[model samples]
Target: MTNFDPAALPAAAFEPISELGPLSRERIKTRLDARGYNYAIDSDGDIGGRWDDHIFYFLLLGKDSEYLQVRGRWSRTLPASSLGQLLVLANEWNAGRIWPKAYVRTEENETLGVYCEHSVDYEPGLTDAQLDQHLGCAISTSLAFFSSLDEQFPEAVAAAKEEIARLTAEQQ
Candidate 1:
């Protein structure tokens, strides 16, 4: 087995974070603020804000990595029993949308909520227009998913439970 060396990779494949990450963060903050979002910079240096009652946040997950992730959370907790239905919704939504992937998460107490996330990568670095487009996609997609789940989850969960019951009864 030969050792793999990233140094052998083309310099064009990587961009320095010092010039990109901080600038991008500042630009994102400035843009979001300009849009009238009141955000807080968290302890891990992530940005958190709210839009239309849903909480949204952004994080630069790595120093050398070009990925910037934005996430939005629904305001309501999903009942634990509805998690399977949430996964089904996420899977269905993911198949149709390329950005702001959907998810369901449970806390220690078993309260669950739906979330949507999108990761933007700057390889050679992004132009201001591209950055704006990516940010817009993130915010728009996240809100779209959040709105879908908020409006539809209860009925979907009921339908899922009914289907599960029917399947179980048929098996019996």
Candidate 2:
């Protein structure tokens, strides 16, 4: 392997970043606002936004709140009958992808919910650039998986899509 010197690298090879700090909701909001994306604050003080008929939440977890979890839920909840099929799909997705760990969960009413999550720990902290990379990876990868689900579950999602559309309009 060729030995590479970090200091010898061109400055242009790197992007400037702000001082590292613990990831916070404010930082998340800053990035979202910068993109001019519409978002909402839940009654629980969680931050979330919708894209392509799906909802995603930017959450800080861990004992010290040092982990960032960007999570998304599919637009539709599958009937109980689909649980077995969904489990297979989730397993296949996890086996094939590196980002966005896909999984299925049973809701209280026995329906199945498909979720995609990309979580990373930053115990030391993170810079603005690193945070942006996390956000981008979380969103793009999750969307890729969601798009596959859309194709696979068109009949299931069609009704949910209409409901979400109606709710979105009502909010407006």
TM-score to native of every candidate shown: 0.71, 0.83
Question: Which regions of candidate 1 deviate over 4 angstroms?
Answer: 1-23, 154-172
The clash tally of candidate 1 reads: 0
Candidate RMSDs in order: 11.1, 4.2
Model 2 earns a TM-score of: 0.83
Write down the lDDT of every candidate, Cα atoms only: 0.76, 0.87
For candidate 1, the lDDT comes to 0.76
lDDT tens string, model 2, 56-151? 999989998899999999878888999888888889999988889999998978988899999999898898888888888888888888888888
Find the 10 residues in a row with the least total lDDT in model 2: 12-21
